[model samples]
Target: MFKSGFVSIVGRPNVGKSTLMNYIMGEKLSIVSNKPQTTRNNIQTIKTTDDYQMVFVDTPGIHKPKHKLGEYMVNSAKDSTKDVDLILFLTNPDGELGKGDSFILESLKGKQCPIFLVLNKVDEFTQDKVAETLSKYSKAFEFDEIIPISAIKGKNVDTLLKLMVDKLPEGPKYYPDDMITDVQERFVVSEIVREKALRCLRDEVPHGIAVDIIRMKKNEKGIYHIEADIICEKDSHKGIIIGKNGAVLKKIGETSRYELERFLRTKVMLKLWVKVRKEWRDNNNLLKELGYKNVK
Candidate 1:
């Protein structure tokens, strides 16, 4: 019989949820960084075969809300847990489980589906430590299964997948075989630009930034031309992005262009512009316009 279902990957920030999803999907369907809250929205990555199709929902990290954006992210993560067939709760092996992890676990205590406790970054843990960590988490909740994995090193990831598939109920495929993710091409392009911006900028700058793809087209010569605007909240921020002699913006453009070309598998001509949106985060209308609404 075939098996298929939605599996939500929920965890504390920087615990490697996105990295695991990208590894499972065999593609970079979501962006990754050393920064926390890099993933702000729910991303669905589909892994399809002839018999089974597992739709994995990669969610924003669960954390205390510091702003409207943070609230949205936390809510997004929680929403995924309520309806999934299984919840893969990730924890960092190198760090102790703190209030944040406890908060998430308490929230999930009432969830209907089974909880799969995944200890990520196992490459950083010793065999004895891995066993001890697993025992500690097992005491927190009666998890359906506990697997130690290193999402970056591909360690025990296959075993986790096999166990997950084994528990899924019989069902038909939900998406096509070649389909990897549900996000649109425009959203992908915008996120690509945002990812580059996040990599280039530091501290609060990445947090204040959002990217919108204004135009994308292809010429007869088979070159893809794209233009996007990077929205920032302050003129000082804009100045930093633009850099002296416009060097910083140039670097962002060049780096983003290379990635876009590689993703699209074609030549890419990208133009980037930065604009000040003036405290757009606090402006509900602006936030909604930028697609940040939906938090209650």
Candidate 2:
């Protein structure tokens, strides 16, 4: 029998939701950073085999909104719980159930599907602490299953996969075997540039920045040429991104070009420019143009 279904991985910021999805998919489909609100979209990563196909939806971390963009991200995370076969609610063993997690659990309490309280980053804690955390959360919401595993270390993750497959319903494959993600090439390319920026910049600049792909084409000699604009919110921030003598922008470009070459499997000629769009995060039209549209 063929089993297939969608599983949403939802959690607070920096709780390893993207890490778990990347580990499960065996590829870097969703970009990762230690910063909050790093993931801005509900990216679907497909894992297909002869027996089963699991669609893992990596959502933005649910948090209180401070702007229209923040509201969209939180709503995007909430919408995933309503329509999935199961929820691998990823969280760290923070010793106690905090407000951020409690809010998410209260919402999941109304959902129909099974929910797995997958405690990630188990390698960072002691066995007793992990056990204590499992016990504490078990009383809060009556989750379907509770397992502790380190996503980065592949510990007990195979068992997690087994439990997920057992819980899935029998259905047909939703995507072709060769396909691994639901996003287009342009979206992934833009994300790659954004990921590099997030890694290089400080706390304030990364969240206010966006990458716009202005041009992407290939030449006859098997080389890909790409051009993008790194959008910031203020003139000073533009200077920060560009840096003195263009050092920081060069760093972002070089790292992005390396990743693009790997993803596209060809030589990459990348061009980057920094531009300011004051408070673009709060601008509704600009938000939609930057691919933060509300499909819900």
lDDT of 1 at 88: 98
Q: Local error of candidate 2 at 42, Å?
A: 0.4
Candidate 1: Cα lDDT at 96: 62
**TM-score for all models, in order of appearance:** 0.95, 0.97
Name the Cα RMSD for model 1: 1.6
Lowest-sum lDDT 10-residue window in model 1: 287-296
Tell me the number of clashing residue pairs for each predicted model: 0, 0
Model 2 global lDDT (CA atoms, 0 to 1): 0.92
lDDT per model, in order?
0.88, 0.92
Cα RMSD to native, each candidate?
1.6, 1.2
The local lDDT score (0 to 100) that residue 145 gets in candidate 1 is: 92
Candidate 2 lDDT by residue in tens digits, 44-108: 99999999999999999999987888899999988888779999998898687899998999988
Cα displacement (Å) at residue 75, model 1: 1.2
> Which ranges of candidate 1 are over 4 A from the true structure?
293-296
Error of 2 at 188 (Å): 0.5
Which segments of candidate 2 are over 4 A away from where they belong?
none
